[model samples]
Target: MVDADQTFVIVGGGLAGAKAAETLRAEGFTGRVILICDERDHPYERPPLSKGYLLGKEERESVFVHEPAWYAAHDIELHLGQTVDAIDRSAKTVRFGDDGTAVRYDKLLLATGAEPRRLDIPGTDLAGVHHLRRLAHAERLKHVLTNLGRDNGHLVIAGAGWIGLEVAAAAREYGAEVTVVHSGPTPLHSVLGPELGQLFAELHREHGVRFHFGARLTEITGQDGMVLAARTDDGEEHPAHDVLAAIGAAPRTHLAEAAGLEIADPAHGGGIVVDERLRTSDPDIHAAGDVVSFPHALFDTRLRVEHWANALNGGPAAARAMLGHDVTYDRVPYFFSDQYDLGMEYSGWAPPGSYDQVVIRGDAGKREFVAFWVKENRVLAGMNVNVWNVTDTIQRLIRGRARVNTEHLADPHIPLEDLAP
Candidate 1:
């Protein structure tokens, strides 16, 4: 039983934190809620940064979750440009750096999120080498692209994940010579599986994007204040004018660990460990979004998904638990990526080597298809490329834990809606 006057301090003002604050207010919790964000801007959507924002198709103001006036009207205090330096669990306070303010909370939500992983290779700190995470990063990249003369600049991306591919697509659209170096056998192989990944490889190649699959970069060399070349472990060198490191991201968990909270093992991958109810080891503190690892009932495994859908859905679930109404974060995970006029949607969970059956719902050669991962007649996961409606149907089917015959799933004539539970 918590008092209505008690304060709730939410660290990190990304989508998760903003959604939690909104959920708290919507659920009729009239306590003092303060959202602390490190960025100058209010909580903004990050997925568009690599695609629409990078391509200049979306305005900066369009990224914000809510207007500043909205927060003021809702009585939610927005602490912009403030970084949480430390967490004092014993004192139930968080120390911020910008103002050196120590705020105590009756309840705290950790949504510090993640930072872009950097390449440890030599000369990675040189000029013309960058990593995209914040709006500042995108602005810097945009400046570089604008000044470098799109027709002549060579952009080298160091990963094949969604961010790397999206950035590559934007760069290609601007007429930059784009090349992606990935250690994986195919782009998005780990997420979409090999067969579908192969299709993406062909698509990118057809668009004049070069790929170095299974190639590991050993070092980045700079010449005369600019990135000159990248050397690979296989003794090959590739010339480049700019380098973008998109190796992935790790959870920002230092503050949580310093506060004596149980952290997830690196074996389970790096992130804080949380229960199904989104509560950490300390019930007074909760965690959600990309920073927390929790068990997935569908996959029968623990996963830390750094997707927009997870942040949006899990944040509200955490708020429910904080307000003494425990709700499991069991929604089927979904995410999207826009690359080169193609939209991709992924739903459900699929552990490596777990799916025994895979069915393609449409023509893969035509650049529109839905690949379903099935285990023991149950739809475990799905990835749809350029098929929007199928993704929505798959999302509902996943939530219902629908079981379907793989044979019918492969037949394009069989309506996917009929597979509903």
Candidate 2:
């Protein structure tokens, strides 16, 4: 039980921070909690920003996790638009901006999250090029799409990941000419592997979105206050009116590092270093969400997973640990992406270059399939396209370490439930 006056300072008011504060209250912690967010608005859903928000299918108010009044009702001090400039670990206080007002905390949760990586090419500062990460970024892009008109407008996306593809689908729906430039051979190769990556390449091509596979971008050129063309290393030039660089995101670790907190290397390519209980090097501080780098039980190595489910799960896990109920944060990792009338879902952990066999269930040609990644007679991971229901069963089998027969796995006649342990 926490003392009624114990102050819990939570940095970053995104999904992880918001969820952690809510979980603290649910866990019977009647403490003075302060949530500091650089953004003025309340926490909003980011997933919709790339799809529905871009299409204007969702409103800003609708995307907010909770209304401003809800924070007051929960006795949470919502400090919006205030950036924490530095941390004084010796004094256990956080100093923000020129205001010099210091916030002291008995416990601190760093959910600082990450920001979208920007293209370091020429003309990147042009008015037409954008990167979507926050609600503001999405709103700006939405305004551009509405005012500029997508009909006959050329949209060039610099990365072929989920965000890039989703934005492409939305832009294409608006009758815009879309082109995806990927340095890799295909789309989502790092996550979905080569076979499914090629399938996505075909799917996007069928939708009138041109793809430049294995093409490296050298520079983004602009003229007369607008983006003109993107130059590639292979001497291929793509004319563009608007450009979006969706390369990826790097962990926001400046604050943590400035506070003298130890950070994990990007060798695992994730974020902050954390233990099973989500505790960072500084025992008083805990981290979760995309900013955390922790060891994976399934992969027997450290991994940094960026997914909505991870933020939701990890936030509460850190809260429990802070409340003195330490539990191992071990669960099958899961992620989902909705693109062009198709649902893509993945579960479990797959080590790089370790899979020896793959079992294809259902028909890939029909765009409905589940691919099982197998190694040493054990299922490592599963990717389901347009088949969400099978994810739960697959996750269960993977968690139980079930050895499924390849013959039955490849047959569409066999139900997934029968293979469950």
> For model 2, how does the per-residue alpha-carbon lDDT over 221-249 read when each residue is reduced to its tens digit?
98887898888889999998899999999
lDDT score, candidate 1, position 195: 69
Candidate 2 displacement at residue 363 in angstroms: 0.9
**Alpha-carbon RMSD, each predicted model:** 1.5, 1.4
TM-score, candidate 2, is 0.97
| Shift in Å, residue 330, candidate 1 | 0.8
Candidate 1 global CA lDDT score: 0.86
